[model samples]
Target: MRPMPHDHSDHPHALLPPDPALRVKALETILTRKGLIDPAALDELIDTYENRIGPKNGARVVARAWADPMFRAALLEDATRVVADLGFYGRQGEHMVVVENTPQQHNMVVCTLCSCYPWPLLGIPPGWYKSDAYRARAVREPRKVLADFGVTLPEGTSVRVWDSTAEVRYLVLPMRPEGTDGLSEDALADLVTRDSMIGTDIPKVPS
Candidate 1:
């Protein structure tokens, strides 16, 4: 729907960062000069993603699934329909797939072809996600990538790398952490991070 999401790494003006902050400012200036966007409105939209409409939405879905076995079953069975029903489908997120990370298996996602991602569910993709280094290394060395993310699994644990395309995007369903037995849905949601849903990390147990 959004012009077949692909890597713009080759674009001369593509935003890659040694200084993402400055790049953002320059892009904003150009767009403003072109009168394509209102700075005030743009700031508001950025604020929405930063504060309100971020991974919090996906966290709610994860939290609900953790608390309700029925919902979890339905989510795993039909991620596209179930997530759309929950109002998390848009653009690159039109085709949703939920891959669960089990005690014996871990799932991580990469867009080897391009940076296709579930933006509606995960909000903005992290800068590292779009880097050529990440897109390339994630598939070739997922365990190493996970370790860089501070996740070291047991030797017996198998890692699965899923590649996203223009047709489909994936969300990793991380296992609920231990010691969350008595926590409410909201409490559990707080423990879910964007990295956890991407399979690079697991939900943290609050101390």
Candidate 2:
């Protein structure tokens, strides 16, 4: 008879009482048998969370910052207070840092060691961002990785790569899009995409 595939029974954590045993076991079974999480289902879950409570809430913060120069200064100086000022507080986001992208200096964020991200402000990261390829390559070769993402930096421009660590998180402040001179706060918030928040894309004025 063919030998049964080696079991993972010897794993130390296998038999240990999970904090939430039933849910943990169900997730493990799905991952083990299927070898992948269902992207569509994950997207649905993300959509539900976003609609219920996600960056759209944070978009209002960005809109307010864009409209108010003093608030923008406060946000750049101390993100936690600015976010708190707008009533968008969380355990993780309580110590936030906002990085502004200017004509001369551009900033991109990544987590080299792990997937440390500001979930309270930007919601769940996209699949590409959490992938090993992106995590490794982004820190090792930031400009090249950004180029692949269709974000070409100007010649002689310096690219700063920030690695998000414990106790500190970052959010990118994309430049104000053109033709938004007199737009309402809600309208501006509608244009603030997650990509803009991550420095992968600039917000665009709706046509």
Candidate 3:
């Protein structure tokens, strides 16, 4: 009797999925073939996101937190609920927690298991954020990673790393920037960067 066709589903190689970039490339190829998208249009789309969505949204959240103590308290206590209160809550961010950074303590976040993140408030995770290099090195060498990101903690400040898992997501509520005292919430939000929301960068001073 002839052997049945081999089954590969249980194989170790089969257990690993293809890279997401491959899927994106396949989709782009299909779109190009169908004449639905041109190369220039695709480049423009990428630029739109690079300039607009992620960092800009994060800056808005930070600015609001700085101007309103009550809102800040709500954000720290329950990030998802508070963010939803501002109309930013959505699919991936049904559960969220905001960690506060202080003079004595600094917080950094990572998804050691997977790239689980609060997407609604922060938008898409940057390319580097989802890389194995970042995930492996973040927990293993947090201070060095923060330094590379241009964030320097004080000599005595304690570093706290929050590892986001599938069940819960996290955001970092950075301390309010100086020179932003009299800025309105709308004006302040523009200074917030996605990095600050993730604890990698701090808000820039208003010029």
Candidate 4:
């Protein structure tokens, strides 16, 4: 047996339903009633973001950077232009900066104000990325946030948190997995997960 979810309408984070599923449903209903959104279009949009556009574009970028030193340097130096060169630039990704994760330091991205993200590369932002808890705690306790996301770093590794805004967005360049030097770029791209690009996880090594 399972207990029912309680309403948190009285809480400070009111307007946000207690359950995230319910929160999204409520928001959808409100928007639909106001004639601000169309249900069919919304469903199609979510489907496109989730399946068609999500992560694959970012994986291509990551794979290219891993296979080419020059591209990696250019990406880290001028992500906005470099990513646009690959045709992954749009509304939310106009001004982009890329951060590299190294042996000694890790980088994480968050937008405390709102859900500013690179839509062309990553598609729609995940629910947690826009949650109040993540927005508030990621900056204050990045290690804990990473831990919550099932990522653990060595004690000596330092974490750097990047705050995103309407003006500038960030893309995390996760370290290329070991033993992948011989893999083709397409195969390597398969190892790059959406969470890895967000700095919440790392690229998986092929079996």
Candidate 5:
């Protein structure tokens, strides 16, 4: 997917960076011309993965973990198998790890080299998540990066950043919110935001 417009504030006199979409389109055109892939079929596949198979799959997983102690233990012990057993397995998400967020420690995921992520669960990664700024700063200065996302953690809370690679990706299991003991699995799923699963933000508390 094409990323949003980039900032050129640091180099006001320099030309803006090349639009990544232009390069992607050029490659797609060349591939289509070479009969490497049909544009229509390619678009269809992308649409299905991006739209049809969305973050709700992950929401369900998070919700189940929240409502079931056994499942949560299984998830924390072996996330790959737990998710696969629940039919959330796929190419980029074949290897997965779950990190728990606690009162004293917060966990966040980043891809230092590339936008490697759990696609089958989280679906498409957000533009900011794939930005150069996030890839660099999330590791260097996590609290500042999180603050930009409007997530202010307590000073005592230690932020642990996990770098995702092609071999394995991570999902953050945000601590369950209070007053949620009565919620159903689907209701709990509603509270599970994509950013929460990524550890940039916490789950939306039920009112």
Candidate 6:
């Protein structure tokens, strides 16, 4: 919805030069010279965020929504509270809005200004999500972006793009795959991918 004020000092970019490319070089030069930061440690931290702490938490939320109608209703009505009920809430996720995907309408989330994603639900924002290309094109040509991610919708389905802001981050509750009626919530969560939760892709169907 609206952009919210955020503290940027903790952001790595805030500590470096304005140019994204030069930032790495600058950080290396400065940190190395001062002996304040270790490259290996930094790499490990990034790896942790990118891999280990990913969208598994969000997948669980989606699984719950799919299994329980009341929880789904509450999630759609008041996402912040519903998600917090599951012990997931912090920073960018303080104010959240959950959009459901349907046969008629599909929803996508993007942050035009900056990467304001729900860390509690989705963890650290992906590299592409914060890239300038994705930030600009996701709003300009969402269908094309989706296509790039190998997601093609039917001609009749309408696409809605939700612009995320620092104030309110949005999450897409992707449609549950068919033939999963007998699957438990944990099993269902295994089918939910990070891209699916972000509306860039769809959930995987059991074979």
Least accurate stretch of 10 residues (summed lDDT) in model 2? 11-20
Q: Give the TM-score of candidate 5.
A: 0.85
Against the true structure, whose lDDT is highest?
Answer: 4
**Candidate 2 at residue 74, lDDT?**
90
- Where in model 5 is the C-alpha error above 4 Å? 1-26
TM-score of structure candidate 2: 0.76
Q: Candidate 3 has which clashing residue pairs, if any?
A: 59-192
lDDT of 1 by residue, 42-76 (tens): 87988967886668888999999999999999999
lDDT of 2 by residue, 141-196 (tens): 88888777778877776777788867698888877888899898899999998777
Query: What is the overall TM-score of model 3 with all chains considered together?
Result: 0.76
Count steric clashes of candidate 6: 0
| Candidate 6, 1-207: lDDT as tens digits | 977677556865675788977987897878888989888888897896777656998999999999999999999999999999888888678898999999999999888898888888999988898989889998889999998999999889989998885599889999999999979999999999998988999999987
TM-score of each: 0.80, 0.76, 0.76, 0.78, 0.85, 0.78
Of the two candidates 1 and 6, the one with more favorable lDDT, higher being better, is: 6
Worst 10 residues of 4 by lDDT: 7-16
lDDT to native, each model:
0.88, 0.78, 0.79, 0.90, 0.89, 0.89
Residue-by-residue lDDT tens digits, candidate 5, 1-207: 977677557654233336877767776777899999898998899897878776898899999998999999999999999999988889789899999999999999999999998988998898999999999999999999998989999779999999886689899999999999889999999999999999999999898
- Candidate 6 wrongly placed segments (more than 4 Å): 1-52
Model 5, C-alpha of 41: deviation from truth (Å): 2.1
Better of 2 and 5 by lDDT: 5
